[model samples]
Target: MHSFESDTTPNRQEKEHPGLKLALELGPLLVFFFANLRGEWLVSKFPVLATLGGPLLVATGLFMAATVISLIVSKIVFKHLPVMPFVSGIVVVIFGGLSIWLQDETFIKMKPTIVNTLFGVTLLIGLMFGKSLLGYVFNAAFQLTPEGWQKLTLRWGLFFLFLAVLNEVVWRNFSDATWVNFKVWGTMPITIAFTLAQMPLIMKHSIEQDTSGKP
Candidate 1:
C-alpha cells in the first residue's frame, strides 16, 4: 500500500510498518474472493443477505465493508490514506451500494472500470499540468530523474486505461465466476508482470550510488 503523504521523507513508524501496509491493501481483496466462494454458506447463516441477491451480491457487500475497514486501518496506522486507494474505496462503496440496493451485479462489475479510468485520467491530467503524480506514489521506493518520472507516469496512465477497458470486456462478455477469477488471478499477475517489465527502465534511472564511490 502506498502511504498518501506529501512528505517525501516518511516517519520511522511508517517505514517500519510494511506488513500492515500490505494487509490494508490486499486484505479486502482476499475477503472479496473468499466471500464469493462461500457466499451461499454466508447467506444461509445470515438469512438477511438473501435480499441482496446471489453470491456475487453478498460478496459485493462484504467487499464494500472490507474496503471501508481497510481505509480506516490505513488512516489509523499511517496517519493518511493513499490517494488511489482512497478514491477506489469511495467508488467501491458507491457502486457496491447500488449493486445491493438494485440487486444488480452490473454496478459492482463496473466499479473497477470506473476506478481505473478515474486514476488514468487523473494521472494524464496531472501530466498535462507538468506534474509527475506517479512520483508522489513511488518516491519512497525509488528515486528517478525528471525524465524518468515523465516516462513512467505516461506508461502507468496508459496501463490504467488498458485495465479499465479490460475490465469492461471481461465483465460485459463473461460469466460472473470468470469475472471474479479474472479480477483475482488475472489482474494481479498482469500488474506484477508489468511492474517487473519496467525494471530495466527503473535501473537506468535509479539514483543509487556505486559502493566503490565512482559515478
Candidate 2:
C-alpha cells in the first residue's frame, strides 16, 4: 500500500495550475453550450454547418473536437492525461461522433447519463474489491485517512449514480433547449455544491491532524 504522503501529492509530470486544469475541463462543455445556443447564427455564417443537421448536431461535432483538443492540451501541458477527463473525453468523442454520423441527437443527449453511470459503477466495483478509486481522481486535492477515503469514495460513487438518474430525468422529459440549459447550468452548480458539502468530512479526516501538534 502506498503511504499517505505518497498518495497526496500528484506526480511531477501531473502537476499543473488549478486554473489551467479547470479551464481544460470546462472548455469543451463551454464550447458545446455556445455552439448549441448560437448554432443558427453560426450556420448562417459558415453555410456548411446546415449539412450537419441542426444546432444540436453542430454542437455535438464541435463538442467532440473541443474535447479532443482539450485532452491534447492537457497532455501537452501536464505531460500526462488526467483520469476523469480522459474517460469523459473518450465518451464525448464516441457519442458525439455517433450523433453526427447518424444525424441523431439522442446519442449526444445520452452521453452524460452514460458517462456518469460508468464512473459510478467503476467506483462502486472498486470499493467492492477493497480499493478506493476516488483517490486516483482527487489525490492532488486531499489526503485523508483510510476511513475517510472509503467514505468519500462511497459518497461520490452514489452521487455519480444520482447524476446519471438526474440526467435521464431531465433529457427525457424536457425539450432539447431545456436539456441543454440544464446540462450547462444545472449540473455544474449541483456538483459544486456537493463538493462544498464534503469539506467537513475532508477536514475531519485530513492527514494534517497527525502532524500538526509535533513540537
Candidate 3:
C-alpha cells in the first residue's frame, strides 16, 4: 500500500526531530568526556570500577556502553540506525574492547584514527566508482544535484583523512587528558566549522522540492 515516495522519503518524525537526533549522536561522546574527567571520583564511590584498569580504561568501557545505548535509542525512536554513528559505534566497541582486554591504551587511543581513515577511504573509493556514498547520510535533510553530491563527498573524504592524521599527531604526542580533550572539544568545533564552510555549495546545488514532494 506504500508508494515509492512513501517508501523512500523520511518519515515526518525523522524530519522534525533534529535536536533529539543530535543528542542521541553526541550523548556517548559527552558521557565519555565526563566519565574521563571524574573517573577517580567514580572509582572512589564504586571501587568495583577500578578493575577496568584506570580512568581512561573506565572511560572507554562507559563510552562503549553509552554508544550501544545511543544506537538502541536511535533505533527505537527513528526505526533505523544512522549510518555514521553505527559505523563509529562499531569501531568504538572494537577498540574499547581491545583496550580493556589487553590493558593497553594504544588501541583506544588509535580509535579516532582508525574510524576516520575508514570513513575517508570508503568515501574516496565510492567516488572512484562513480558513487556518492555521502548521500545516505544527508538524503533526509535535502536533495542535491549529482555534481553537488560529488563535490561534497570529495571534500568530506579529504576532511576525514585530515582528521585521521590530526588524531594520530595529537594522541601520539599529547597526554591522555589532552588527547581526550581534543577528541571531545577540538574535533567537534573543527567539524562544525568545516560543515558550515560547505553551506555555499549546498545552497548552490540544492534541488527545490514542491509541496507535493516533487523536485
Which candidate gets the maximum TM-score versus the true structure?
3
Best by lDDT: 3
Listed per candidate, the RMSD to the true structure in angstroms reads 3.7, 4.1, 3.6
User: What are the clash counts of all predictions, listed in order?
Assistant: 0, 0, 0
Q: Which stretches of candidate 3 lie over 4 Å from their true place?
A: 1-11, 14-19, 210-215
TM-score ranking, high to low: 3, 1, 2
Task: Give the TM-scores of the predictions, in the order they appear.
Answer: 0.87, 0.87, 0.88
137-173: candidate 1 lDDT, tens digit per residue: 8887689998889899999899999999999999999
Q: lDDT of candidate 1 vs native?
A: 0.87
Predicted candidate 2 versus true structure: per-residue lDDT over 103-194, tens digit per residue: 99999999999999999999999999999998876766668888999999999999999999999999999999999989988999999999
Error of 1 at 37 (Å): 1.5
Q: Write the per-residue lDDT of candidate 3 for residues 16-120, one digit (tens) a residue.
A: 887887788789999999989999998999898899989999999999999999888877777776667788899999999999999999999999999999999
Alpha-carbon deviation at 214 in model 2, angstroms = 13
Supply the TM-score for candidate 3: 0.88
Q: Looking at candidate 3, what is the lDDT of residue 61? A: 93
Better structure of 2 and 3 per lDDT:
3
Q: List per-prediction Cα lDDT, in the order shown.
A: 0.87, 0.86, 0.89
